[model samples]
Target chain A: MGDGPSNEKGAQIMSLFEVLTIIVPSTLLTAAPLIFTSLGGVFTERSGVVNIGLEGLMGVGAFTAAVSTLGLEHAGLGDASPWIAILFAAIAGGIFALIHAVVSITFRADQTVSGVALNFLAAGLTIFLVKMIYEGKGQTPYITHNIDKINIPLLSKIPVIGPIFFQQVTYTSYLAIFVSILVWYIIFKTPFGLRLRSVGEHPAAADTLGINVIRMRYIGVVLSGVFGGIGGAVYLVTITSNYNVSTIAGQGFLALAALVFGKWHPIGAMGASLFFGFAQALSITSQQIPYLDRLPSVIMLTAPYVLTLIVLTGFVGRAEAPKADGVPYIKGQR
Target chain B: MIKLVKKINWMTLLVPVISVILGLLCGAVIMLVIGYNPILAYQSIVESIFLQPYYTGETIRAMIPLVLAGLAVAFAFRTGLFNIGVEGQLMAGWLASVACAIVFGHLPRVILLPLSVLAGGAAGALWGYIPGLLKAKFKVHEVISTIMMNYIALYTTAYIIKNFLYTEGERTPTIPAAASLASPFLANLTQGSRLHWGFIVAIIAVVAMWFILWKTTKGYELRAVGFSPDASQYAGMNVSRNIILSLTISGIFAGLGGAMEGLGTYQYMTINSTFTGIGFNGIAVALLGLNTPIGVVLSGALFAGLQTGGLTMQSNAGVPVELIQIIIALIIFFVGSGYVIKWAMGRLTRKGHK
Candidate 1:
């Protein structure tokens, strides 16, 4: 009878260890892309331009990263190929986002409509290029050089914290977390951030202040593209390793959800992404866990979205977007 | 000539025309850059749709869902709501219709068929109602909520199909013929294509959308609310109810679109790992159609024809079918950015006057 209690305690400890080593690392890995993408969302929304095209932007990034990585690897660039591909992905995303910027900002088209078009363009253009490059194949060839997980040298020597946070974790995850802090500092601490916020909150006022509202909005949107591109590239390198129609399926939207759930704050976005990523990781790894395997897989799959809905319903709290978000900034117009 | 142009509402007609031309030109440029003969590809798409009776029928059949989906989107847009969940609602309808047909296989054809279709509409309405209700009661953004509902519908349907309705092919068993919308006469008329009675249903929906928005007091209220909710509320309109009603009506149209596929085109639902793209296409259709009833039909026909003909372009000219999607996207872009086109047209008219 006494031995039974000890054995039960031992099992509980083992599961705890498994969760830290397995689930925690995977959750961070999964959340890294969302963190990056939602941070991008934060920038655009803070600047008062609603970017529903983040999903498509991420798709462009994924495609660019996959294709460039494949080419670079073939050219014998070895381990450095994935990193270079990330740069190309960011550039491609920025260029693609320029279309949205011009249409929504310059032409003053409906932002939502323009974003939808951006998505369609990204999907079609990427798949068309994929087929053309791969000799009519619908997907890209698997990339050989993937972004592997690494251990922080001395930090990884710590017992529980090291295993959960430092060991066998993608550097991209750390980069994403670091970027979140940086974004926080930039958006909250800097004059540029204030100007971007002013443009979003009240473009007419910003214009009155001679802040160049349109220019600030443009920078905000393009920065989203850059971060979104990096998010997609990191996701491809770490998780998928190939570009297909469904590869970046809903991550961009999830990031958008994260942005909303995070209330458009950088650190909040990171936290929300981690939570959503935990839901995704749970679904993916549920089959291995003893009790969770009995739960329906659909529950896990739908958890992030359902939670977002609940959050939006103000059960948790209200999320108010920038006042001028999605509205075209007309000079001298209130 | 200036008087005639002014009287003709020329800008409305000119914008879509110029957009289409620009879209096609952009598509051609893409093909040229890729070292393909754009002329041959274009010719092939044209020939296939015109020369082949089967392709023409298939295109019309495809238009049924596209038209309904467009109406769904246009309807919501008229009410100042974006129903991005049409895809999800459609999925729910597709499954519900198929499941109803399968479960009620014993009912007479007359009763079963309409019931199955109505079941689909109701299912879709329920899916849409969640977002509408949330938006009405909690001030949640319809776009975000609808987007979330889509993933929920997708996962839930997939799970239900796998658990309860699994067949050998990872799909529901074929729905009963009693609940089918397949029309043998229409199929024979179209050279054995899968044309069905759903075309009639689609036509009715188009007329319904037009009549509701233009003729009904409720629709006036919805449109009023869309234009300015504060003014409408001040004018004694129930803005919240109108918002909910608009989305539910939108859901009905989207549901009918799904039923067209379930009853007429496929006769069953399959597990979809991703969106069917029809819902997103509906947004494109509604936008290009200028959110008008008549415009939707014409744009829907155009899109359906392009999709049907795209296969022939692939086979005949060795160009990928996704090029058509690119063209459609360009068309949407041009339409969204109509200001540039209008400005250019204004400059052209001024030069002509000089």
Candidate 2:
């Protein structure tokens, strides 16, 4: 794969091999955050709550992770700071999400409107705190202990798959994929999952079955917060290595899109995240590829969004959400 | 007078007023928690907007696009659709208006100015029409589609500018005087602020929204569909068509808002790495305004004041400008959870009776 090609076919094959090595690992890195956040979306939406504020939740997570890591590193935590910061992010994200859960659940406000408010609040509050904490700076300073990539010991020695999957990758990516499968099990195979889905599908029926509708929804929303927080932290430590207003950008929205595109299933969401991540990878790597570099960069830049639109138009009519999704549960109504 | 007072809907009037006060209070609390003097912060905001001519002018200038953006969101809300694509539509409009102005630089102001603005509306409408069409035909959700389109607009517009209108400073060349909305008279009146003639256009858009939503048969059908799509369909109104029309009209308002920024405020389009955020703020504006035209104007001015005045607060009171954002967000939350307010209000009225 490294030497000069003797023939045209050999050169094409070598390039393909080279491209795979670069693209696969990058795709995993990019998809890791989305995988976590979209799984969060899956939980929230499946419990009949719509969380457009995942973007804001992610922002809160990123900010918390950055600040905590910096603080912990200053406290002489060494390499453990970033990992511990993820837990802090999850707590912050969960607390921030409680605002959405309370407003939409207990207060029975318009869920979408509440979610929008949550986004605004998260964006505003995080930056406001940043300014207050960082001596009026608009962003946080970069943390010293960013999470590093590692190759799996035995797996990195395997022939083709080694370099692509097990080499030079962050453990967080594997954790994200693993969590999605666990979420699928928890959401599909468990009685708790049954109650959660039942509440979303038909709250009155679920209520009749002695299920606590409001409590289930609250749990769903908080879980989303936890997962989304981890996602944001992972992105911060592995990719951005700091927190800024633009650090999370539209990844949360992309995760939401993945959730919808995946038809609200956890594994399906993970698959969709991978696809979107692949599109993102293509855009970033396009300038490096010989033939792809010639095309206008906008095509690659907008591919994920454009492709999501196309995919939705083609298949979303059949993509049904949970029956009572976005509807607040009221006692003894209808 | 007493009878007329009794006939009024106090809840509508009280909810927003209380929400604003509560939002400000929340901002104050946050500031105090952060070791800043909230009183000084708010005082500076008020003083700057009222006492300084430039800040006053800037506040009004800022209100122009905000008013139009609020109308876009409110108009769609009234028609039972969420036009989250306003950001994308605004970008498309910004690009189209500037592109038109630059290309038609030779035309008279009477022809070129309106043409450029109309081009913006057209571009926005076209951008809006896609999601509307998809929703109408394929049942695709507009929220997700519009969100996707925002990115598409961001990247696509950046690409177009880089490829075709490349110039120094990473932005397009300025439009000719004929197409510019800059008014020397307004600038002089505002003490050399960036105030422009777009204010009039925003006022007209507000009135247009009110007229179209309340005075026309099409508007009636649109509102009916919004009230109940199934009932409207059974009553022989075209639900799908109303949905499409609602989003398209919403796009026009959003696009015009963009034109205000492109032709009036800046006079050229710069590639944007993120959304201008006027669209998202429109949601807060519309919600706080209760989706009414008169209400939108008042809320738009209030938000404009906060934003412009926030700079003064930041400079004068050692407070951050983001405090204003927190205040606005709190207002949206308070307004959205009107249930809580109403419940409390109910208890207060009962106590008064006792």
Candidate 3:
């Protein structure tokens, strides 16, 4: 009971609801970044553009958000102004997405390769800016607490579930969820959605239908960029609250998995993202449990990726991606 | 004639030139936004690393891994496989080479050096095969599987480094001078330069790969499979076997990269100390090279130059080394959308003819 492992074990085994209480909220919070990026990915893929640089775009968003958030605070707006940070992050993310759109839709470059380039460029640019400004201390000053967590008034009073699931979460998770719903509607319900999906499924056919594949893809990729930016900003403001190299870490890749495992469906991807988030939460939670606690930390870190692998192999059955997802559409292929 | 010349490969050169200029211009704009002297900074970047021979040698040291890693990815890319696992493969190669060097410290250089190099490559090949097997056998998606394998390789390598191999501060040892592939005579001939014969070896490897890729039956088979696996399978090519073979070849390239790092520079490998991300960077190398051996070498040099200059930019201009990573990411964006480029170029040439 005295040792760290024993106490950790005690915490791990306490009760079913206890695990859920800790897990549900953290999972949502963890899933928030993925949710935003997946929405971004879904946007592009549905419109027949595959944005692999969402990770890079997200990194850009995170770095810019951190700097601007800090800047805003210095300018006396205070760190509590997440609204301003989010706007700034959107611009940052948008800029990266615009670059992706130009190379991919306009230049007709390889979508996957372009995304990778964005990642490198963002990483280099962010690190350069951080170092040039912050002088290699590895990160920026932590965001003020006021700039972070906001508890809902009536929601907070709704018993155990409220505080655990709703109280502690950054507003980004809620925004991502709202956007996921909005994206679902936008991808499947509206006229723009139809054109986007049509372009994705068969660009030539869509072209015959008078749909502009390039324009749709550009919108899709740029939308992804916007969401990716929000994801990054949210990640920094809510989770890590400080900018560092490892701050973004492997979250981008995991989110990519979430997007894929969701089979490119907006709602389905939400479920997948939640699953990954829970896996991450469980990995941390297992630290307290005795039987699993004895396992190596490497095993713990490997768990989420392994789960992704399993999900990919299992549920990724017949993942009918957009026909033009990675294919650059030529006006006269025939 | 001028237009015809421009139509041939001029755009390939043109795009890169335009991209470089634009990328630099964007870089300058960002520098200004953040309040820095872009000209002085860029100048320092050009001078600080290139002007100094020692720095240039160190840059070459970095370029070795980039070149090999790029080859690994370039091999896979040409085979129609996107290998995200190069990072892990490279790490595995390092681990294997280090294990051989540490355990067989007394072996003569003539036999041991080659043996260690082979062992490193073999390890990476095995690691690389995991995804190939999964993709070929289980009908799994290669992209997801490769990414997962990367994690497995990284964690497995880290675990091995911690508990089994690199334990008790014995993770690194002073490599015997006998183990060095370089001669002191050659070192002196380079004017106190660390530019080892390894650079020469890398060049040779590139030329050899170019031969294998373009001048061999296996190369034809690989290219055919890459063109369309279903069609190749219909034509009696073993799709599964090719997938496995391509990955194995790719892994060998990565493994050799690790071996180079160990043999050429470190002379001994240390856990957690090998240049990480070089494998991932190899993908960038392949992209920049447009999936050719010569392209890989040139792109590797370009990247090497940027990486070298990036450090200087950090020290002098307050730019982050990670900015280079972002640039690489941007390049990947363009490369991934290669189809777009082909389309646009076609349109341009067609319009020109009209």
Provide per-model DockQ scores. 0.83, 0.80, 0.47
Q: What is the TM-score of chain A alone in each candidate?
A: 0.97, 0.96, 0.89
Q: Write the per-residue lDDT of candidate 2 for residues B304-332, one digit (tens) a residue.
A: 99999999998899887887888998898
- Docking outcome class, model 2: medium
Candidate 2's C-alpha runs over 4 A off are A1-6, B1-8
- Give interface RMSD, every candidate, in order: 0.9, 1.2, 3.0
Tell me how far the alpha carbon of residue B116 in candidate 3 is from the true structure, in angstroms, after superposition: 2.6
- Candidate 3, residues A288-312, lDDT tens digits: the string is 6446568776776676677666665
TM-score of chain B of each: 0.97, 0.97, 0.89
lDDT of 2 by residue, A196-226 (tens): 9999999999999999999999999998998
- Calculate each model's fnat, 2 decimals: 0.85, 0.85, 0.81
Q: List the residue pairs that clash in candidate 1.
A: none
TM-score of 1: 0.98
The backbone clash count of each candidate, in order, is 0, 0, 50
| Candidate 1 wrong stretches, greater than 4 Å | B1-8
lDDT ranking from best candidate downward:
1, 2, 3
Global local distance difference test of model 2: 0.90
The 10-residue segment of model 2 chain A with minimum total lDDT is A1-10
